[model samples]
Target: MSASSITSQDLSIGQIFQNFYRVPDYQREYVWSESDAKGERGEEVEQFLKDILSEFEQATKDGAPEYFIGTIVVCPGEDSVFDLIDGQQRSTTSFLTLCALRDLLVELGETVPSTLAGQIAAQDTNWQGETRERMRLDLQYEDASGVLVEYGEGRGKNARREGTRSIRNLANAYDTIREFLSVQFPSDANGLRRFHGYFTNKVKLIRIETPNVSRALKIFETINDRGVGLDAMDLLKNLLFMKAKQSDFGKLKDVWKGVTQAIYDAREKPLRFLRYYLLATYDVDAKLQEEDIYDWLTRNEAQTGHGIDPIGFAERLRQSALAYQNYSRGRNPAGGADHGIYNTRLLGGSAVKTHYILLLSGRHLAPDLFERLTRQIEETMFVWLIAGVASKDYERVIVQAARNLRRATDAATFAKFEQEFLVHQKSLNMQMFRNALLRLHTYDLRKFRLRYLLAKLTRHFDVLAYGEAGRESLSHYMEAKNDIEHILAQGADDDAKLEFGEGADSFELIQRLGNLMLIEASLNRVINNRPYSEKIATYPSSQFLLARCQAAPLTIGVNDRITRAIQKLDPASSWDRSAIDRRQQWIADAALEIWGVPSPNPKATSEFEMLIPSPNP
Candidate 1:
C-alpha cells in the first residue's frame, strides 16, 4: 500500500458523465438482471424506476427532491479519464437510460439533444491510432467487442444476439431500460422530456475518487464488509442450536467447533464444505446454489434425517470436514502426497473442488482402492478440463458416482462403478484430446494454467530421463531460474515476422505450444529475441529435456526414451515453422497419454447397473 489521496464529490447523473469513465479489462462483465433481480442486483430494474419517480413526485413545488443513487469508487487516470472500480452496474445503467431517452425523443419526432448524444459517445482514438467516435461507456474487456457502442448509438438491431455473456447482458440491460421508459411515458414526448431532465439532474450520486484502483478497492472494502458465507453458516448453526434441547447444547457446540476448525485449518469456506457434503452424500435433485441451501434444508428436514438427528448430521460434517482438510492440502489419510492429490490440486479453474463431493462420499473405501479412484477421477476430470467441456455435465456425473460409492460393499462393487465411469467418457478419447491440444496456445491460458501445463509436460519427460530426482529439481519451468522460452522469439521485426509467417495468423502462431520451451532465464535474457541459430547452444545445458533435446549430442541422463522422443529433430539444421509443428505434435502425443481415460473392458460392459447420471443441461 502506498500513501493515498482521496476526494469525495456529490454529482448529478448528467454531471457525473462530464468526465470520461472506462470499465477496465479486469472488471467483470455487465451481469445485472432485468427480472429475478434481488438485493445487490437492484431488485429488478422496475424498482429503480419506480423509486426514482416516487422521489420526484414528492416535490413540494419549491424544488424537486434529489434521489441519491448510491456511491461509486473510481481511480483517476490520464487525460481526465477515471478507471471505474466499483458501481459500474449503476453507472452503466444510467448511461443506458440516457441512450433510451434520446431514442425516445427521436421516435416521437422531437429534436434530439446534442448534449445527450455526447453523454452516450464522444471522440476517441482506436488502437490503430485512428480518431473515431467511441461510446462513452467503453467496455474494454475482450468479450464486450464494442457492444455498448453498437447498442448506445442505435446500431444494435443487426448486432449478433448469440455473443459472449457480457455482450448479451449489456444488450439485455439496454433493452430493459428502453422498454421500461417507453411504457412509463407512453407516447407523450413532454413526459419523456421532463423525466429525462429530472433523471439527469435530480438523480444524484457520490463519487469517491482515489489515486489507484487497488487503493480505491481497499477503501471500498473498508466502507463495505463481506461475510455472505460466514453469515449463512452462522445462521445454520444457530438454527441447529435452537432445535436442540438445552442439555445437548454443550455437545452440539463441540461438534460445531470441530467442523469450523477443520474447515478453517483446511483454509476452505465452511458453507461450501457443508453444501458439498450434502450433495455428495445424498441425491440432491435441485441445483443447490449457496443462497438456496437454507430454504432447501428447512423444507426437507425429516426426509434428509437432519431435523431428527442434528447431532448425527453435525458428526458427519465434522468427520467429512477433517477428511476434506486432507484432500484440500493434497494429502491422503497417512498425510502423504501420493494418490495424485497434488495433480488434482494443480488443476486450474474454479470448479476443481467439486470432485470432493464424490471423494468424501467414498471415504469408507479401502486405502488402495481409494487411491485408484482418485486417479480415475482426476484422469477423466483433467481430460474434460483440457477439452473445455462444460462443468455442469461433469458435476452431475460426479454426484451420482459418489452415491454409487456409498452403495459399494467390496472391491468388485467399486470396480463396477469405475468401469461405468470410464465407459461414460467414451467420447473423450485420444483423438479428441489430441485435437484439443492441437488448438492450445499458451497466451490464451490463465497464468496458473499456463505454468501448470508447461510444468506438467516438463515434469513427465524429465521423470522418464532423470527418474524421481527430476521432480525434486523443478523450480517452475522444471528447473530453478528458468523462464518459459519462446524458442521462436516474439520480436515483430521483418526478419522475425518472416521466420514462420502465416500472414495475419503468424503472430498467434508464435504463442502456440510448439514454439515454446523452457530455458534458463539467464541464457534467455542474452538470446531472448535472437535467431534460433544463435540460441541453440544455450539449449544443451538447459534442465528441461524438452529444450535440452533440441540441441545435439545430449549427454546428461541420456536414455532410449529421450533419444526416441527427439528422433525427428536435427539440431544441426535450422529451426523454423516446420520444427515448431513437429515439436507440438510430440507434445500433443504426450498430452493424450497424460490425460487419457482408459477404455472399459468388453465383458465388463452391462455387467452391472450403469450409475453415471445424465447431465441435466
Candidate 2:
C-alpha cells in the first residue's frame, strides 16, 4: 500500500529548476474564470488588510505577534533539493514583495548583495530554478499554464489584475511602515529595510518531508484544500511522476501536453478526453475506479508491476489518436472516404468491435446503399441519443448488428434476406439493437428545436428575404441558404439566433433536424430570408388540391394483405396477441423458406421453433 520514503532535501529559492515541475500533457488545462477570484476574496482581503492595520497599532504597543507572516511547504528531494508542491502563491508573493523592497532599498542608498534587485527582474528562471542565470531574488511560482509569466500575470485574468492592485496596496503598507520605522527605529534605513527585516527573520515556512509519492500526494491535496488549490495539470503532473517510467517520461510528457492542450483548448471535459484517449489507445473504457486507474498507471498492483510508462504510452497513444483523427476527418489521400460514421464512433484497439465492421459492410453492399443505411441508423434522433449517452454499449450492439447484417447480405435471395433482417425480432439479439435505437428516438428534442427554428426564421425573416425583397416578394424569393439551427447548434455558423421561440430553451434547440442542417450553395438565395411560416403556409392548401388532382382507385390496406399472408404461413393456431401473431407469422414464412421447413399453426411449437433457422437435417 505504501513505498518507503525517499531521502529529503532542501532547494533554495534561487535554483533554476528545469523539468522539475513540468506538467503532463494529459492533464486538464488552466481554466480560471474571472468570477472565481474576486467572488470570495473581495471581502476577505479587505478584512485582512484592515486587521493588519489594526494589528499595527497593537504591534507597536504590544510588540509583534509570536508568529511569522505566512507559511511555505517544502518537500525534500534526494540531494538537498525539494519540490515546491504547495506554497507557490505565498512564495511568489513574497518574492514580489521583496523585489519591491529591494528596489526601494537601493533608492534609499542601502547596501544589498551584489545587484540583488537585478536578479529578481530577470526572466530566464522561474524562481523555482537554482542556476544563477535562472536565479531570482524573489520566489518563483508557476500557474496552471506552467509558463513563467510574472507573478502578477501568472494567475487568471482577475487574479492578475487583483495582484497588481495588491502590489500597489503593499507599496502603501510599506509607506506606512517607513513612517513607523522612522519614529520607532530612528536610525533604520527606510520602509524597505523594515519590511526586509520583518520577513527574513519574522516569517516561518512549515516544511514537510515525505519519502513516499502517495503520502506526498496526500499532503499536496491537504495543503491545496487550505486555499492553495492545485490545478488539474498539477495533480496530473504528480501522477505522471509516479506513473511514468524513467526512460520514457521525457518524450511521453511532451506528447501528453500536446494531446491535452488540443483537447483543453477545444473545451472538452477532462474525463471525456481521458476516456476517449484510453478507448483509442488500449481499446479500454475508463470503467475502472479511480484507485484502479492509479494502480494501473503506477504498477502499484500486487504483481509489483512497474506502472505503464505514461510518457511512452502517451506518445504511442498520441500517434494513434492523430492517425484516428486524420482518418476520421475523411481526408485520407488514399482516394477513399472514411469507412463510415459507425467506424468513426467505434474507433478502438480491437478489430472485433472496431471499424472492421465497416469494412465488412463496404465489401458486401454498394457504397450508396450502405451510406443510406448508415445515415438511417446513426442520424436518427433515437440513435444519436444512444451515441451521446451510452456510447460504449451502443457501439457494441451496433457493431454486432452490422456484423449480422453483413453476414445476411452474402446469403442467397438478397431481397428476402434484407427484408427478414429488417423485421423486428423478439429475441435478445433484436431487443438490444432495438433498445439502442429507441434510446435515440425518445431523446428530449425540446432542448434544441426552438434554437433551430429561430435561427431559420432570423435568416429568412431578418436577413435574406426581408432585407432586399420585403414580405410581398417573399413568395418569389428563393436562395441557397443553410439551416440556422443546424449550423449554430453544430457550431458551424455565426448567424444562429440566440432566442428561437417562446418557452424554448437551449436544450430544446438541440433536437430538431432544421437546427441541424446547412443550406446547400446550389439552391436559390433569394428565398433564404423568407419566414418558414410563410414559406410553408401554402403547403396544406396545395396538399388539399393535390388530393383531388391525384385521386385514384382505392387499394386494400397493406396490413390486411400482411394478415392474409400470415394466415397462409400458420394455419393451425388462431391468430391473437397482435405482436406475437405478426412476428410469429413473419418468422414462419422467412425461416420455412430459409430452412426448407413447412409452416405450422401459429400457436404450435413447430411454428415458433421454425422462426429461427434450423441447424441442418
Over 4 Å off, model 2: 1-134, 137-205, 209-240, 243-249, 279-309, 320-377, 380-617
TM, every model? 0.56, 0.40
lDDT (tens digit, per residue) of candidate 2 on 1-617: 22455333333333222113322222233222212222322232233233433444345533564333343344444334445555554444445444544544554577864334443444443356764333232222222332233332322112233233234333333333334434443545554454454444434445455654356656665554422445343444555555665465456556766655444332334443443433323323335333334334434323222245556555554453443444344322122543334232332212222332233333335545555443233222122232232444444433434434545453344334333322221221232323332222113333333232222222232222114333322112223243222222323122222222321334433433222222333221322433323322322222111111111212334555323332233121211123222433343233223222222223322111112221110
Q: Would you give me the overall lDDT of model 1?
A: 0.69
Worst 10 residues of 1 by lDDT: 608-617
> What's model 2's overall lDDT?
0.35
lDDT of 1 by residue, 1-617 (tens): 23577888999998898778888664545656522222222234556777888987776657898999888888876555788877777888888788878888887899977778877777876567878776677677565777787667776554555567566666666667777888878998988888887888899999998887556656554544332322446556645654666577668867876787688667676678878888877777527776666666767777666667888887887888889989887776556655466566666444478888778887888888888877777676666666665667767767766777788768999888876664456333434556667777876566566666777777766676656653742335534576787777777445555654553136677788887776678878877676666677777777667677775746434557666545533343466677777778877777756555444444544422333322210
Indicate the residue-level lDDT of 407 in model 1.
Answer: 86
